[model samples]
Target: MIIHVVAIIMELLKLINTFFESALFKKLINRKRSLNYIQFQRADHFLITLSKTCKQ
Candidate 1:
């Protein structure tokens, strides 16, 4: 029946949406981690420079 076909299509769409949502969530998490790492490296570099200047 048409109703069954429509129901199946809706389920497929829901599954696809769930998959994309998880994928996007993972990408966002990775981006945040990379950003944090970059910030940490910059802070470390600044501290090293500050120490060298103080020593000089």
Candidate 2:
């Protein structure tokens, strides 16, 4: 019984490792690339706010 449990655990670990090695996992790791537009908008808004504060 213990051996079977260990085998199952190892299989699960292998599957998780394979998932992390896939392209989807790499895309997830590069998630910041997908947020460039959002980041740019946030930066523009911040600059606008700063300019407004400075003017006041």
Candidate 3:
């Protein structure tokens, strides 16, 4: 029973490691980075627009 439990734990760990190494995981990370970048870009644009409107 203990050996079976250990085997299961190792399998789970391997699965988790593979998931981390997968392209899907990398895409998820990159997606977050891009989202952050887009948010910053949007904020910069909004600030610039606000300043222009205020000046006008």
On TM-score, the candidate that comes out on top is 2
- By lDDT, the better pick of 1 and 3 is 3
Task: Report clashes for each candidate as comma-separated counts.
Answer: 0, 0, 0
List, residue by residue over 1-56, the lDDT tens digit for candidate 1: 96686567556656754764687756865778777657756865775575466446
- Compared with the true structure, the alpha-carbon lDDT of candidate 2 equals 0.65
What is the TM-score of candidate 2? 0.53
Over 4 Å off, model 3: 33-56
Kindly report which residue stretches of model 2 are placed more than 4 angstroms away from their true locations once superposed: 32-56
Worst lDDT 10-window in candidate 2: 47-56
- Using TM-score as the measure, what is the rank order of every candidate, best first? 2, 3, 1
Output the number of the lDDT-best candidate: 3
Q: Which ranges in model 1 have alpha carbons more than 4 Å from their true place?
A: 1-32
> Which pairs clash (backbone N, Cα, C closer than 3 Å) in model 1?
none
